[model samples]
Target: MADSVRSPRERYREQVRDEVKRHAWEQIASAGVTALSLNAIAKEMGMSGPALYRYFASRDELITALIRDAYRSLADTVRAAAEGGTTAVALAGVIRGWALQDPHRYLLIYGTPVPGYHAPEDITAISDELLAVLLVVCADPAAEDQKSPFDVLLGAKRGWVAKVLASPRTVHRALSFWTRVQGVLSLELAGHFAPMGIDPGLLLAEEVAEL
Candidate 1:
């Protein structure tokens, strides 16, 4: 990697870029991404408005970087867990802790999208990496195929999962795992469960335990 043999200028550029992203995250934490502003970031960083453009050309570009980073972090964490032989339930706990530690970062990836803001291909690819890790974690490689109603639907869309998991049932399980955890997590992080007397973690563990 070029970073392995970085020159001074390249290192400096990387530092400045990281600082810009840090400020962007702070802004996101204070307000939503809709409130993000390059000009405002420039003012905070003590750099001219135009100078900030050297690092990120546009607001969308910065959002892309942040999204990519968030997805990459989750992917890397999942991969590490898989390598460490973590169980699916434990992996779910890892994800829960990560999201709770930084709810804004969690929402940045899984939160509602801004209208008309289509993510770039690279972002989608990184997202698929996260899914791939989930597949590996959730795959019941030794289990026999079990056809459900959704199996037919998922088989029709086996364009990606078929390559990683040999069993259709396993693919369906992985899908269920992702959707179920995400459903519970989104609400928990959004404070939807605060009004309820029950613990959200118990609810989440129950869902994952069933998986």
Candidate 2:
């Protein structure tokens, strides 16, 4: 309600910012993130470079906004699945579906690092939300029977995991699950599996079922 009651000036500013981000995504699609130019976007939007700077102080700031949006979106999707009593396998499927729906957004967050770009601490907070949901869904009682060496090491500092009330083994399991899913998505998005006649979806199902 408070948001809807925002003054006209605030609403217009947000609209402009949103428009700039749309153009920025188009630029990212055509060229890479390194090729993003605020000045170019200003020309495309009929605004001077300095004027656009009022909306986004620097390219890094705009990139942060994009990254934050991406992470927040994935976090929300997984959180919803978790709240709906999604199982480990089902949650993995949900994540896979989300990635398939928007490969660009998925890659933007988890793909190669943007050179000279450092994500703010808030981005880490959003990513931690993802891990938290993974931990919840990955709590397998059968996993408690097997203790790997890595699990033993991870058990020592269960600081964050403890906050989520997940065992060290569950944390290990969640990490394993996340890495496998990400590996498949990264390779699949890059079109590496097509040439090999490999089915990424089947591969993902097998990987998640193993957990």
What are the TM-scores, per candidate, against the unseen true structure? 0.92, 0.94
What are the Cα lDDT values of the candidates? 0.84, 0.89
lDDT of 1 at 53: 99
Identify the leading candidate in terms of lDDT.
Answer: 2
> Lowest-scoring 10 consecutive residues by lDDT in candidate 1?
158-167
Across residues 77-134, which tens digit of lDDT does each residue of candidate 2 receive? 9999999898877887889899999787888899889999999999999999999888
lDDT of 1 by residue, 1-211 (tens): 4887999889998999999999999999999999999999999999999999999999999998898889889888888888899877888888888899889999998999966577899887887777777777777756545678777776777567566654667777877888888998999988889898778777877898797
Q: For all candidates, what are the clash counts?
A: 0, 0
Candidate 1: misplaced stretches above 4 Å? Answer: 1-4, 141-143, 161-165
Q: C-alpha displacement of 136 in model 1, angstroms?
A: 2.2
Model 2 CA lDDT for position 29: 85
> Candidate 1 clashing pairs?
none
